[model samples]
Every structure is written in structure tokens, then in C-alpha cells.
Target chain A: MKYGYYPGCSLEYTAKPYDLSCREVFKALQIELEEIEDWNCCGATMYMSQDTLTAYSVSARNLSIAEHQGCGEVCAPCSSCYTILRKTNRYVKWDPHARAMINDALSAADLSYTGGLEVRHPLDILVNTIGLNRIVDRCVRSLEGYRIAPYYGCQIVRPVYHFDDMDNPTTMDRLFKALGAEVVEDYPGKVRCCGGMLMMTFEDVALDLNADLLEGAVTRGANCIATVCPMCQMNLESYQPQINAKRHSNYRVPIVYFTQLLGLALGIEPKKLGLDDLLRPLPKLAPAKPMEGVK
Target chain B: MGISQSVSPPLESELRSAFWDHVQMIPDGHKVKTCLQCGTCSGACPVSHAMDITPRGIVALFRAGMIEDILKSRTIWICASCYSCTVRCPAGIRVTDTLYALKRLAMEKKIYPDKFPVYALSKAFTRNIRKYGRNFELGLGFHYFLKTKPSKLMSNAKFGMGMMKRGRLATRPHKIKNLWEVRAIIERAEKIGGGK
Candidate 1:
């Protein structure tokens, strides 16, 4: 399987581990990723708030680059990027006024975008397109005892019905089970918002949302939470200590990118997957020693 | 505070039509006029407790053209854009998108609550994008921390250091290769879209 990879800005800096582990997992799966050349920020929601046409134009520019590269399908690892790109692709295709306005900006750069590109999230590509059969065939180490809570933040499944249910998505759940981990069913935080854009600006609100998501998962006996979006991973992983301090709770859930777990299950070294690069150390998938009385 | 204190006399016809026109222009925002007042959006909002005005109230206010009455409240800034309200609205109102449109309109009117970090942070983010054609995390942090609210620097300093140590934060901006192209795009977009 081959794809045009659009690893948004976060994957390059804040979420480097996601990009690293994602590449390794795809390599193990024999998937090819061609990073789109000269990609710009997807403007997330902030840019859209400032100016809709400019935001659409910026998103269009990225698609135009991918289209120029002759890539019919472009995959973004970030949920916000995927949503924005997909929205632009769909908007420009259907809304002639928006299309003309965005094209006017594009024409200024000697670029005119004719939209037909398929914008996708990596999770969509992995579970839906690649098929679990291929993934199951490549898993060298079974995560038989590991308990993972799959957290898909708001964007991927909402507003646009791509490949999963909007309210209760199971792509990651099935993906994790395919890798041999115990999927935490009925996890309330499964489709919760991570307050991605507000993390920095509205710290209090963001922290509260993050705490709910972590608490929801850990209360369900999840060893750790597995996530697909960088914003979700970073928000949950980096703020657990602070959340614990404020709430006076002893929660130590290590948030890991789903790709990192996939890499581990595929027999990729921990170091290669950038496990140690996480703000919080990786939680053991299984206990180092058996409990004295539990069994 | 009850809703009556802020209510202005029914909005002038011209102003009411203008507001509706703007909302109707954005995709799916026309649903603003179709709000059922069922309070589904308010119930679905995770941060509604922090909001002074409920999400449903905001929609009602927009439809009523009493935006000035709603503008001062921190409700719009508090929205996490989670789409819970958008997805759950039985009327299919783009609650999230309408909120975003209201945010922009609020910013344009300079009515967002003073000293609110959301405005400052968004300003810093847009400034970074305009300067480099891409968001520079380090630049954004500095701009937001130093320029908007320096007090946050001391509190968030540890997280800042952690990001730097883990190589998650950059000290300098990362400019896109074809920056001129990006600039031209932004310039033309501003010229065309700003006319409104």
C-alpha cells in the first residue's frame, strides 16, 4: 500500500514520536508514504475563524501541491488537518462561490486547484483500506495482556462520516484488538473532545476536558490510552501530572500514540518507535511481576 | 444575570437582515434561523458550565440579532470546537460553525472579553501564520507569552522547558520553502475577503 503522507506541523515538532512510529508501522506493513512536498499549515480552526476564504485558500494550496504531485489520495496524520483538507476538498467541489473565491487566491500563486483528491486520516487508511487481515499477518508480538482505551478525538468521525461511526467509533478498537490487545469497551472517553485548539489559550477548560478523558479511561481499568491525533496525545500525555495535582487524584495513565503500539506489536524496537520520547515514560503493557494475591 | 438586562429593543430591520445575511453566507450556518430552542446544544457542550450564556442561548441571540448582548459574555471564547453541539443539534444547525462565525464577528467588533487569552492567542497564531506562511510554535509561544500575558510565562515555564528538552518545541520559526507564494495567496485572500 502506498500513500501521499501529509504529516502536519505537530507531527514534525510536538508529536514527532507519532510520525516516527507511524512510519515504522507502515514500513512493517509494507505501506509506502510519500511526504507531500511544500505543504503548509492546514489553518486548523483558528485560521478559519480569522478568515474563511483565506483558510480555504491555504488548505487548497496544500491539496494543489498534492494534486500537482499526481497523488489522487492524500493522507494527513493530524485529525484537524484531515478534517480541514477534506472539508476544503468537499466545499470547493460543491460550492461554486467558495471555489471561485479560493481559486482567485490560488491563481495569484500561479496555481489553480481542481478538486478530486481523497483526503484521509491514517487511522482510516489502516483499518478500512489496509484491512486487518494484512495487519494481523504482520504482528510478530501479541499484546494479549495489554489493555488499551482507544481515544479518537472529535474531528475524524464527526461532521463527516468517513469510515467510522460519529458518536462511537470502533476503527481503533478493532485495530488494537487485531494487534492482540484487550479493547476497553464502553469507554466513555472514546469520542470525547481533547480541547485541542484551546489547550494553550484556555488552559483551565482544556485541563478539565483532558482530566475527564483520562479519568474515564483509567477508571475502566485501561492500562494506557492509545490515540490517533497528535493534539489529543500531547494534551493527555503532558498534562496528566498537572491534572492529578489539581484534582488530587493519583492518575498515571501513559498516553501512547496508536502507531507506537502498532510498531511494538510489529516487533519494531522500542527506541525506533520513540517510546522514550514521550513526556511521561511508557507504561508497561504487562506487569513486571505477578501480584501476590490477585490471581 | 437574567437575559432581560442585556436585551436591546428588537433589532432594526436593516441590522437584522445584515446579520442573517452574514450567517446565511457560511456553509450550514443558515440553520441559525431554524433553531428549535430545544437546548440540545447547551446540554451537549462539555464546557457549558464555564459559559455565562448557554450554547442554545447564543444561537437564539444570533437569530435575534442581539449580538451585542451576547458578545460580552465569555461563552464564544470558551467553546472548544468539539462539535458535540454541532453533531447533536436535532435541527442540524451548525452550532460549532455558527459559534466560530460569531467569534470572528465578535473579534471584528472588538467585543470579546478583555484580557481573555483566547483572543490574544488567536492573534499571535494569525500573526505567526502571516509572517512565516506556517505556524511557528516557538514564535507563537513567545508572542503569546511575552506580548499578551507575561504572567503566564512563569507558570507555564516548566511545560515550556519540557517541550524544549523533548525536542517538541523550536527556538526559531520554520518558514515554508515557497514563502512568497504563500504570501501572495494570503495577500490576495485578504484583499478579496477583507472587502466584506
Candidate 2:
């Protein structure tokens, strides 16, 4: 299956491993990811705070490019990018003024966004489109014994509610199980915010939020916290040390991209999936027997 | 700490029509004006304690025509935009977007809390996006630190070096190939009072 990919800014920087593993996993799954040419920033959460029209216009520019490339479905690895892209798509369709303003902006570059493009998260593509059965069929090295906490963060299932439950999403949980990993079914931080750009803006607030999320996973005895959002991984993983220092608690929960875990289950080398690039050291996992007759 | 209550409430004629006009401009902002003020937004907010006024109080301030007070306070700038308030609002008020509207208004009025690094970073981020068509992390960090928080720069030097060593942080901007197209869109949107 062919899809247009918008890696967003984080994929090129702080969340590069997510981009790397995402591409590798998709390639192994036989999905073609043709990148949208000349895509700009998705305006994230901050941009919209300043101007909705500009935010919508910028996000729509990406959609227009995806549509221009003749791709019906465009997927983003960053939850913020996916959320903003889809939010802009919906906004322009209803808000006439926003639509006109965006159209005016688009026309300057000879681009027009009719708002029909389907913006999806990589998790949505894997769980909904590719189907869990197909993912399980390709798992060669079962992640059987690893207990993983599935963290959806806030954006992916929220506001849009396209393919998963908004309050408590299970796409990542189910996907982890399919890959032969033990899913932490009641992971509380699943729908909580990872403090997002607040980490950069308001350090104390973001750190506090991160502490709660990390503590929730660690307390639940998760081997590692698996997430689909780059920001979540960055906040949860990078800030663990500071959070521990601040809260006077010792926790070493590794935050990994779900795609990276999927790559491992597919028998792809850990290095190839950028596993070593994580800020936190990968938690050692106990080897488990592959389920009999699985392959 | 009680900044919201310190200001003398505006007279009826002092109520700016522009505040309501701005609210009506966006669908979400319009919804916020219809808030029930049930305090769900305030309660749902994780960072409300850090704000000068709670989310529900901010909405109440808007409804009561306290634009000047809202602009002067740091509540809008302190919002994490987590959408927690937006998701939990029983009135289906897009509380988060309303907060965004308030931020936009604050930026336009140049009334954000002084010496707030978050506002500085937001400005730097936009400036980077405007110039490069994409965010230049190092450029943004430099711009932010240089402008608002130079003291924190030395502290972050090690982390910056680490990111640089790992090749995660780019030394230069990664401008899109068709940056002029992006520039055009930005300019056009700015002209329409959207990218102010």
C-alpha cells in the first residue's frame, strides 16, 4: 500500500529515531511511504495559539502537496502534526472565513486544498489499515515476555477520534499484543498530556506532568513505555533523570517508539531501528518462547 | 496573586466590541463564549495552578468583557494547550482554542507577562518558521536564550553539546526547497490578520 508521509520537524531532530524506525518498520511491512515534497512545519500546538488562519494555512499547504502528489492518505509520525493537520482539514471545511483565508494563502503558491485528504497517525495506519492479523503474521522474533506500557499521549485519539477511543485508546496496546509483547492494559498515562511544548516553555509544569506519567508506568512495572508520539517519548524519556532528582524517586523506565518495538518483533536488527539512539538506555528484556505454530 | 481581581471592572461602554468580534471570528472561540462556567475546564486543567486565573475563570473574564485584564494576566501564556479542558468541557466549549485566541490577542496587544521565556520561545519559533520554512532548533534555542534567558544558556550548553554530538540538532536551517511558496503563504495569511 502506498501512503504519503509527513515526518514533521521532530523527526529531523529530537525524535529522529522515531523517523528511522517508522520508515524501517513500514518497509518491512511492504508499505511504501512517499514523502510529501516541500512540506513545512505543521504549526504544532504553539502556532495555533498565535493565529488559526496561519496555522491552518501552513498545515493545509502540506495537505495540498500530499494531494498534489496524488496520495489519498497521508500519515504523520508526530501526534501533534497528525492532530494539527487533521484539525486544519476539518476547520477549513466548516469555517468559511478560515477557508477563504487559507485558499487565498494557497493560491499564492498555486495550491488549492479541497480538504478531502485523510490525515492519519502511523499507529492508525498499522492498526486499522494494515490490520492486527497481518502484523502478527509478520512477527518473527516474538516480544512475548516484555511488558510494555502503551502511551497514546493526548493528541492522537483526541478531538478527532477517527479510529480509536478518545478517552482510552487501545490501538497501541492491541498492536503491542499482536507483536507478542505483554500489554499493560490499564496504563493510566495512556491519554494524559506529556506536557508537550510546555517542556520547553514552562519547564517546571512539564517536568511535573512528565513525573506523573513516568511514575505511572514504572509503578505499573512496565519494562518500558511504548509511545507513538515523538514529543511524548522525548518528554518521558529525556526528563526521567530530572524527574527522579526532583521527586526523590529512582526510576529507569525507557521510553521507546512503538515503531521501534514493531521493528524488533519483525526480526529487524535493533541498531537498524535506531534503538541505541534513545536518551534512556533500553531496558533489558527476558527472552520468551515464540508461541507454537505462530509462523 | 489575585491579579484578576485587582483591576477595576470596565464600564459597560468600555467593553470592547473587538473582544467579542475576535471571539466570533473562530468557531472555537465562539463556543468558549457560551461556556457554562461549571469549573470543569479549570478542574480538568493540569497546569491551572501555574496560571494567574483558572481556565473557567478565563472564560468568565471574557464573558464579563475583561479583555484588558485577560491580556495583562499570564494565564493565556501559561496554558499548556494539552486539550484537557477542551475534552472535558460539558458545554463542548473548545476551551483550549479560546485560550489560543486569548494568546493571539495577547501577542497582538504586546501584553504578555514580561520576561516570560515561554512567550520568547514562541516568538523565536515563529520567527524561525517564517525565515526557514521549517524550525531550526539551534537557531530557535539561540534566539530564545539570547533574547529572554541568557543565564539558562550556559546551563544548557552540555545538553546542546550532547545533542550536537549525536547529530540530532542541526547547525543550520533546513529550508524547504520551495521556501518562497511557504513565504508567500505566510505573507498572505499575515495580510489577512491571521498570522499576526
Candidate 3:
């Protein structure tokens, strides 16, 4: 299936690997990702804070562009952009006052909002479109001996009206398990904020909470942490050292995208998985030989 | 609608105005005015039992002009940013985002310390993600405990060792080959936020 793809600012910049891995995985799964022509930032954190109506207009402008391009869905890799855009669509559908204000703003950009189109997170496409049964059937390098901790972060499940189930989410788990990975489960301060841009605004507090969540996941026996949000991925991966330097300790855990792990199970090469591009190096996993000749 | 008239306390008057000040700064900021005081959010909150005041209760406090109590309560910090109320709100007030708005104000006001164990850990988690493209759990976990001087837990070394035996902890880190690139990315991100 083909999708209109919006990688957002972080993916275009800080989280390029998320964008790269997304293309690689979707290609392997036979999904065509047509990049939206002349796409700009979704106004992720700033517009939302300064002006709600304008935020809706800008986000809707992007969505309307995809619809104008005739794409049925706009698949976003960044959770911030996904949440903002989805929430904007949701708000405009019910509140006529908000709808009118945002539409008037959009008219300035030569755009309009008609909210039937779906705004999907790439994770949703990975689970819902690739279809778990197909994911299971395609598995080659099973994660049987490895322990994985799937972290949803806040934006993905939150504003729950826009995304999936807030509590007791199982989509990520089902995908991981299908790849032959042992799923590590627990209360992970789940649905907790990774402090988003707060990492920049309040560095100390953000790092502190990072330690709490990462430490708890490690103590719980997760060999690795997997996530779907680029902002969360970038935040948690970048901050571990300051945390270590402050205490004069060195703790290293590899944060990665689920697509990387799935790519491995699908027998894609490691370099293609962007494994070496990680902030932290991963431990040796006693690499499994891939199955020869799968259609 | 049936209504009863009573003396509107002065305490309520001051508090309500302040809450509106908070409301005005946010996107979809005025949803506070539409709050119906239903308790669905409090009911759905996973940690509501642990909160000094529940999510819906905070709205009641704001509406009643008792926001000083909100400023003082540990309830703001207790939020995981789960968005339970944001999803469930009849008015859709952006509950999680709004709490964060309060969090910024609370921090500036010194309403609470930044010393919560969870706070330290989360900060480190985000910092590391920025440094590397991903997380290195080994460095992150031990790094946090060392900084906090939660060394009192050192007596529990046997427990740590036992877990190590079970292959829970990796003594050796899996260093990514593109360390320079990782360093560059962190540098750029830092520049974007400006001196964090």
C-alpha cells in the first residue's frame, strides 16, 4: 500500500535513523511511502503553545495537502507531529468555533480542512498494515533468546482520543513477540512523560526522570529498550551520559526502533538496520544465522 | 436548572482568577472554563489513589479559587503525562499538556524540588537519547544511582550480582561504531535548544 509520509522536523533532523529505518522496513514490507511534496515542520511544540487555532490550521494545512495529493493516509514517524496533527483533526471535527477559526487561518495558506482522512503513526502502519500475522510469517531471525522492553513514551498513547489504548497497550508487544523476542512487561511509569522539549528547558529534571525509567527497565531484566517516538528516542539516548558524569558512573543501554529489530528478524543486514549509528553500542547477541531463501 | 445561592468566599475569588491566568497561556487554553466537574478523569487515572488531589479535583480547586493549594500540592509532579484526562475530558482541555504548563510555573516558583529519583532518571534518559541516537541502558542505570548517592543501596550488591548471573545486566557496553556522528548529533540538538 502507498502512504503520504510526513517525517516531521526531528526525523528530518535529530531522528533521521527513524526516518531511514522507516523507509527500509516499509520497502521490505512492500509499502510505498510517497513523501509529501514541499512539506514543512508540523509546528510541533511551538505553535501549539502560542496559538491553538493557528496550530490546528498549520497541522490541518499539512493534512489537507496530503488529501489534495489524493493519499488516503498520512503516516508520521514522529509522535509529536502525529499527536498534534491527529488532535487538531479531532478538535476541528466537533467544535465548530474552533473549526471556523482554524479554517479561516488555513485559507490564508490556500488550504482547507475536511477531516475524513486518517493520520497514522508509522507504528500503527507497522502493526496494522504489515499485519501481525504477516509479520509472524515473515520472521527469519527470531529474537527468542533476547529480552526486549517496549516503551510507548507519552505522545503515542496519549490524548488517547487520537491514538491507541492509553493503558495496557499491546500492539508493540505483539509485534515484538511475533519476531521471536521475549517480551518483558511491568509498570514502567507507563504513559509517563519523557519530558519532551523539557529536556532542553529543564535539563536536570528531565535527566533525573530518565534515570528512573531506564534504571527501572534494566532492573526489570530488559536487555534492550525499543521505542516508536523520535523525540523520546533522541531525548533518552542523548541524556544518559550527563546522568553518568554527574555520578561518575558509566551505564550503557542501547535504545532502538522496533523496525530495526524486526528488520533483523526479517534477515536484513545489520548495517541497514543502522545498528552502528546508535548513541550507545549494543551488547553482543550471539548473532543468529539467517534462514536461506525465503520468498 | 435548579440553583442555590450562597456566600461566594473571597478565597475562591482570588484563586479562580489565577487559574484563568494559566488557562490563557496554553493552546486550547480556555477549556478550563468549560469544565463540568465530572470525575471521569480521576476515575481513569492509574495513580489517582496516590495523588493528594485527583485530576478532576484540581479543576474543582481551580474553579473554587483555591489554586494556591494546587501550587503547593505534590499532585503536579505525580502526573506521568499519561493524558488520561486529556483523552477523557468532555471539554478536551489538553489535560496532560496543561499539567506541564503548570509544571513549568511550579518549577519557577520553587513549588517543589527537582530531586525526585524519577526526575533525575528521566532527565538522564533524555540526555543520553540526545547523545547517542538511542539509549545504552548499562551506562544510564548505574550512572543515575551513582549521581544520586543512593549508594545506601550498595548493601544490596548481592541482589545486583544475582541478577547479573541471570544475564539481566550487561557489564560490557555495545558501543556504536559511529561515535563521532553520535557526538555531532548531540552537538546540533544542544545548539537548537541553546545551552542546556
Q: Whose TM-score is greatest here?
A: 2
For candidate 1 chain A, the 10 contiguous residues with the lowest summed lDDT are A286-295
- The 0-to-1 C-alpha lDDT of every candidate, in the order given, reads 0.81, 0.80, 0.65
Docking class of 3: incorrect
Candidate 1, B-chain TM: 0.87
Mind giving the per-residue lDDT tens digits that candidate 2 earns over B58-139? Answer: 7777666666777777788777767877778888888777777677767766766756746677777877778888988888
- In candidate 2 chain B, what residue range of length 10 has the lowest lDDT sum? B6-15
lDDT of 1 by residue, A89-190 (tens): 998889998889999999999998888788888888888888888887777677767798999988888876788998899999888877778889899998
- Model 1, span B1-196: residue lDDT tens: 4554544555434445545545765787776778899999999888898888999888677666667767667888888878888888888888887777777776766776757757777777777777777788877777777976689778777887888887888778888889888888888987888722
Candidate 1 clashing pairs? none
Which residue runs of candidate 3 sit more than 4 Å off their true CA positions?
A161-163, A187-189, A245-250, A290-295, B1-61, B64-94, B97-196
Docking quality of model 2: it rates as medium
Looking at model 2, the pairs that clash are none
State the lDDT of candidate 3 residue by residue for A19-54, as single tens digits. 777888888877888987656456565444333444
Model 3 / residue B188 / CA error / Å: 32
Report DockQ per prediction, comma-separated. 0.67, 0.67, 0.08
